[model samples]
Target: MDFLNPNYKVRNLLVLNAAGFSCISLVVFLLATQPFYLSDVIGVPPEKVGSAIGTLGAVDELVAVIVAPLLGTLNDRINGWAWNHSRFPSGSRILELVSFSVLALSLLGYGQFATKLFPDLWFWRAIFAVGVSGCMSIVTVMLHEVNNSDFRWSHMAFWRTQFKNHGERLLDGNGELDTDNGGNNELPTVEDDVFRIEEGPTQQTNKKHGSLAALLGVSTGLGAVFSVLFFLTLPVRLSSWYPDLSSKESLQLSYTLLGYFSAVCGVVVVVFAYDCVKQRRLSGHTPDLELPDTTYFELLKQGLDASRNNLRIQLAYVAAFVSRSTAVATAVFIPLMVYKFYYNSGLCGAEDLQNSLKVRSDLPLKTSCYDGYIFLAILTGVAQTVALVSSPIWGILVDSKKLGSRATLAVASAFGMLGTFGLCLVGRGDVYDPRTATCFILVSLLGLSQIGTIIASMSIVSSVGQTVERTEHRVIGSISGLYSLCGGVGILVITIIGGRWSDHWVFGPFLLLGTFNAALAAVATRRG
Candidate 1:
């Protein structure tokens, strides 16, 4: 509660930002886990579930592409207003509350309607995707606001310094900062002399924007706990409560419930949260922290120009995100393959198969290979987290010119590719007898490999983006969406092919995916 005070506004902002991120994470986790529950618990066929999920991915990609730019434009417009007015006159906080409320209601509807209307897999997917898209758009805007506030402060500091040096000299007898000894003869304080420097409006705006961005990052990371809680609830629901439902129905219900919760949470956020801007007396001194007044069109043009100028950096970001997505999609699909082809198709011991089938009847049960696959997923999460963390660390090194971007990218890609190969070997081989130890080792190695690739890709992009001027923090979300879109395409392709192919050759498609990822990594490394 103490942390929620205005004096600790930055910390409170972090908490709110993290809460939003947690919601996003929950959505992602549900997306990953629900397909399996559909096939295993509710009795949907593996191929059907895979196809349904694939379609959902395609929809997500389309929606994200369409909505992201629009959202970015909207954010730019809002920011422009905030800067010009020095406050959110239209009530930015109110908008945030409304958006979150809408999100929560949508999720609640999804959960309540699952058993009644969205019985079909595709319908459920379409609705879910739309809900997620809307929620994400609002979240993006909130993040942008948070960032702009901080940049405003820094810009104010810069202007203060410039005013002191130049404006002070013109003051007649008084050592005042302002030349005009108007009604109030308040001289510029020492603090006012430290931050002045006039240039383009964009430069002035960035000082505050940077702090806000940092706060957003920190808050989002911490608030991911709610998402974890949401995910934890899924296994219980699918396993215990609706054991008799078809896999498709169960998965649909699960996702609907998750969405409903998210939407409800979003609504709460929008309604309750407020962004309070402190009022200051005007002394002809620049507002200590203010954003730029660049129009949406100008910002859009600027972002486009910067992207075009730094094509290599943009490409690297795309490649890295794609590789990470590919790895995750492949990890998700492997367990499905095991359940559909190996578990029931007489690949394992008869007793084990019988038990698996019984478990499948009641709930989604992991095959003998389930443990291995999950182990791999856990490892991947860990590795990726580590890799993501290391990326910034390495980015700092690259920025200092102590390391080459190409070299960093290559090493990371090589490790990730090697991990992919390792997973392929495990799938290709018949090492099922001593499953526990073998799975642990393989999953760990795979995770390690993924980390390497992820970190390297991130480092390269960060380094390259920093080298370019006028591109700082612009279109970052849109660019991120594009990168995510590529991965979605990959996931759709692999899920479609892998689902059918698993019936014949369980390990073949995984190997092919690994190979493809490896090649992409190699090319990215070279390009970086």
Candidate 2:
């Protein structure tokens, strides 16, 4: 079958979208299950398990900072060669396929090796961390490829506008329309009326592109649902076939299977999916369009120079990264904290805790103190979906200059901080009864806060960058890497402190995290 047909670009996009969702799901699922698997299945102590997990975060952050920029630069230098080469040359697809294969193999090895080797806690954790980081890089490359595709530019512009609109609403719970006295209609100025006519075709094209993009969103959402279901069911299916296996062994087997499946899927997409499509287009009698050959250093210089022109862009990057770091801090130790302090509370005894841990070990799943973590995960997924869907809208609004990115970021940061504070207070209140309800509410609030922050930060980043004619792949990767690095720092701190004091003082870490997040929010808002 012809793989390189330009007409098949939409198909490639669907594949990329699905791959992106799958990659994220796999990362989050593994992360959520790691603590439980290490402590219960592998027989590592709770404290050590926390350290091991924290170390992974630390490693991922460090690697991201180092790798993203370099990889981005490489991507820039090899832009057309990697993406538009007529033949199967060393390009983005090759990098993506190799990285994904390594990631999947590493994960599978960790799962199977844990059963036999019982390697040092940190060793296994580091392997998984590095694997996920590699996968993240590949995903970023794929995102850039998708963005640069002919079909995606208009969609990106629309989403950018959507994101800005969402940011405005988040900042002040209203759309762009003015609330005039008695809600009377306002007449458009002569310039506004003339400009509207001039931009009519562009607006119509954007609307058409947006409608098509919504179909892709639907596909992505469905893919996520399927991926989650597959993960949830894999363990049960394996356990039924291997009933005599230990819980740990079963969990390891499940992860290994999933890893292998993900790797195979990634390889197929990189090889026969996108690359083939590109090649087919080249072989046809179609005219060879000029693809830009921008270097990474050039893009970096442009971004840097652009930031100099607009100080707000630089501040926006810092604010967004800092806010993201603070927001993610709670997740670092929450798993370990729940396991040590709340898992074996009055409701669930040591035996039940052990059994629950065992079950999770057999499957790629983890349940925290009250299984509230699952609820939290669901809420987070929903919020992220909302933010992703609204991104284009926000971008459009920013481009139109209806609202400022700084103001939007500040308000979102404030709301997120407030949510963290609320969670901290609830944790301090010592309310153990109705555990499910309380946990649900807390997680929901966190999800809401996260959604606001996600939208705001994305808007700010888009606003700060230059509109110069060049590929933005490297800049996006570098900024994302920096964000990951900050998150890693936060996770490292939480693991060190929370791991030591969780057993003796449960509330201390929560209180500290809340305070830290609030303080960071204050700093971000001031800078914004």
Candidate 3:
């Protein structure tokens, strides 16, 4: 089947989307499980768990924001060189491979360190951040490369055909030349040309644009669900399978298994993504690639200019900032909240708590901490399931002329605002309380909002990136780099401040999320 780019086949696109799944699954698994590590394995106090997770994340996003821009431009340079030089796998693929290996190695090292060597954990996290940034930045560029001026590469190729004969021998619905024009072989009128130009993009372009958006949305949502559900449940599953191992031991075992799975996926990337970028097949010639070289300076300038001049691009970046923080940060914080409830209420961890001097061994081991893992898994599972179900909703909304891209974000941001603010009104999560159901409902709402923000922002960016690519072949790396940078800023702000606030109020991170979405809603609508 044909996709957006003629050079790359549908299989390559599938491979690219699979890489997204692989990277996101690993990253989400890390975020989902870290709180358990801090609260249980390391025996951090309940109040301090939030701060420790936050500080670690602050460092993660800090390194990410710094490296994203540099790697963004560097990716384009590597692609440019590869385009002109060799047929080997491009830099982005290599980047993805290296990233996956590094992330896997980081996970493998996490639990192996003795308690005395725990301070060295910071160094590994920084390494993990570099791997994550590389994966994200490269994926951003691939998404950008999938389109060019909203199907200009394909549409222009059609328009560049023999216009006069095309008009004279207009095809019927069955692809045969029609004689229905009463044998008149006149060229298309100026009015016809104007209509084609002014009627927005071609229907073919629209179809591919919406299709790709839907595909990626579902891919990401499914990846998150798979990671959260599967990895979060591993501890309990392992405990049941290995009765001799303690819950802490089960958790470490799960982490090690994830590292092995990630390494296997890295091997898959090398096999499939070795030579994805092909020479363009436009106008039966290679004039597009034969044009003047796109200097790094010009490419970088185009990215800055797009951000400075275009309101949609700016909104897309803002949406990325808020939406990414919403996506991954909440994965950390929500499970962290649930785990905290279990720890405080004596539902789990009598011996583990005492080992760290959290509490005296009083309540006789009322329940296993793996139960907390189960609940954490369930809550996140619900959120991502909702995201997967709602992924298509935003794609349809963005594709609609009546609602358009901007209006979709405006409406979706309202849902995000409602969901995040709604969390503030709910009590700290208790598995037994009737109010716990409300937490699920709010999480579902946020799930809907989460997928919306991503689809809307990505659809807009892809279209805008296409427009920019028309003037210059490779401006997307810098734009996507900037996109990651903004997201890093969002994570940095939410993690640092929300971590401190959680000590005082359990719902502090949700409150911050509500504010971000509220501001996004206002700006998105104001421009409309």
Candidate 4:
């Protein structure tokens, strides 16, 4: 609760950011586990599973690309209007609550509907996709507008006024007494007489924005942690609750429970959380809300124009697209590869494996290559958990100025390439069978490398936003939306082809596309 204090506003923002991202992470978790549910539970053909999930991912990302920017522009308009219309000040908060509620209902309905009629699973998938897509876009734009900008905007200005109203004393080196700690006190603090800078609070603003990379990275990673916990417990809990239900039925029921969890969280946020950014403006900085007269089409057009004209933005988009694609491709393909190994070993299909498990449950499950979903859950969980830990570590390192973002990106890219190349070996033949130790080590390496890529690329995007703000004078949300649009493009490009490649050879996509992308990214980083 103390962390939510005004003086520690950044901490409050990060926690809320992480909470919002958890919904998306849970969505990813469900999708990751779908491969097993489709093949074993619903009795779908093995070859078709890849295509279904891949197509679903492509559609999901496509919706996000189109909807995210439009929502961002809408948000700006709403904020501009709320400035003059004082009746409803928390416009963005209202949007968030509504978006989250829709997402919650979508998840709830999708789980129940899919479980009842497996053939209708695709329909549910589309509904959830659209819901989450719009939700993520709006949340992302809100975050960028709230914290990452260089300009103080209304929030900081409001805080300064609070200090003045409270009679807080601020002392400057010039021996002047000031009420607000907004930079008046710091003007005389500079010791450099020859290169005296007029702006005292620019450094302070930079300090906050500099941590933007880490803030976003860590928040996303923490959301993954919640997803890991849900997936790991879902299977066992479902089976225990409904002993009469078959394995497939139990899994379906699990999704229904997951929906409840997501929906409840959404409700909590809506009821308790005020829109922090808008509140700042409504408090004291009301005049700042009068945004320029601009249409969404105009904003979108300018964003597209800037993408072509600004080399920094272009480079940022390329880096983000490649990095996100590699991560998505790896996540989509790795579980399939592991399942193939287990299925070929014959234990995954054995009728007596459960009986054997009941007799000697102490035995290592991996020893028999049975119950592959458990391991799949573990592997994915471990990967996501690693992401959670590494994101902040890498983000802080990159943001600290100790490691240049480009150098960090190049190094991480090279590391990921090597690890992905190692995965190429896991699919060679039964002769190169994966032992438990071998699988864990390789998967952990992949996880560590993937987080590195995420943190580095995100840091690059933050720099891009700052660069655009300096030159374009446009609201940062549209540019942030464009960044997500590139990521959506990357997902679309890879999943459509990668899914087919998986059916042919489990590691084909990982070996060819993943490695090629890594190499290309490494080269680009070096040039930059």
What TM-score should be assigned to candidate 4? Answer: 0.78
Model 1 TM-score?
Answer: 0.61
Q: How close is candidate 3 to the true structure, as a TM-score?
A: 0.81
lDDT of 4: 0.57
Comparing 1 and 2 by lDDT, which wins?
2
Best by TM-score: 3
What are the per-residue Cα lDDT tens digits for candidate 4 across 238-331? 6666666655666666676667776666665554443433444423443433344566677767767767776656656666666666667546
Give stretches of model 1 more than 4 Å off. Answer: 1-9, 16-21, 40-43, 81-110, 115-120, 130-230, 237-257, 264-302, 320-324, 334-338, 341-401, 404-407, 429-438, 441-509, 512-516
Cα RMSD to native, each candidate?
9.6, 13.0, 9.2, 7.9
- Give the per-residue lDDT digits (tens) of candidate 2, residues 1-528: 211122224445656666655665565456555665666566666546655555555555555455544554443345445445545343455655665676686667767665422344345555555555444444444443433333433333222232223323222235454432110123322221222222222222122222232333344434433433455344445655776654456667778887787788667667444542243244452322323355566655654555555555455455444444443443444444455444435432444666765654333332222243343345444544544455455334333444445454455555556655655666654433323555555544444444344444444443222212333333544444443444445555555564455545554555555555465456555642
Candidate order (TM-score): 3, 4, 2, 1
Measured against the true structure, the TM-scores of the candidates, in listed sequence, are: 0.61, 0.66, 0.81, 0.78
The global C-alpha lDDT for each of the candidates, from Candidate 1 onward, is 0.45, 0.47, 0.69, 0.57
lDDT of 1 by residue, 1-528 (tens): 001101112333544565556555655464555455454444455546655554445554555456545444554455446546753632334444444454455444444443322254445445444444444444544444343322234333333354434554446666534533221224544333432222343432332322343333333322332333445345445635765654344445665666555655655564334342221112232232323465666666655565567755565555544454555443455444434444444553435666755644444332323443344345334433443344344434333344544554455555555655666666664423323455455544444444444434433333322211323444443433343444445555555565455445555455656665566656655532
User: For model 3, what is the C-alpha lDDT against the true structure?
Assistant: 0.69
Better of 1 and 2 by TM-score: 2
Give the lDDT of residue 102 in candidate 3.
80
- How many residue pairs clash in all the candidates, one count each? 34, 30, 1, 0
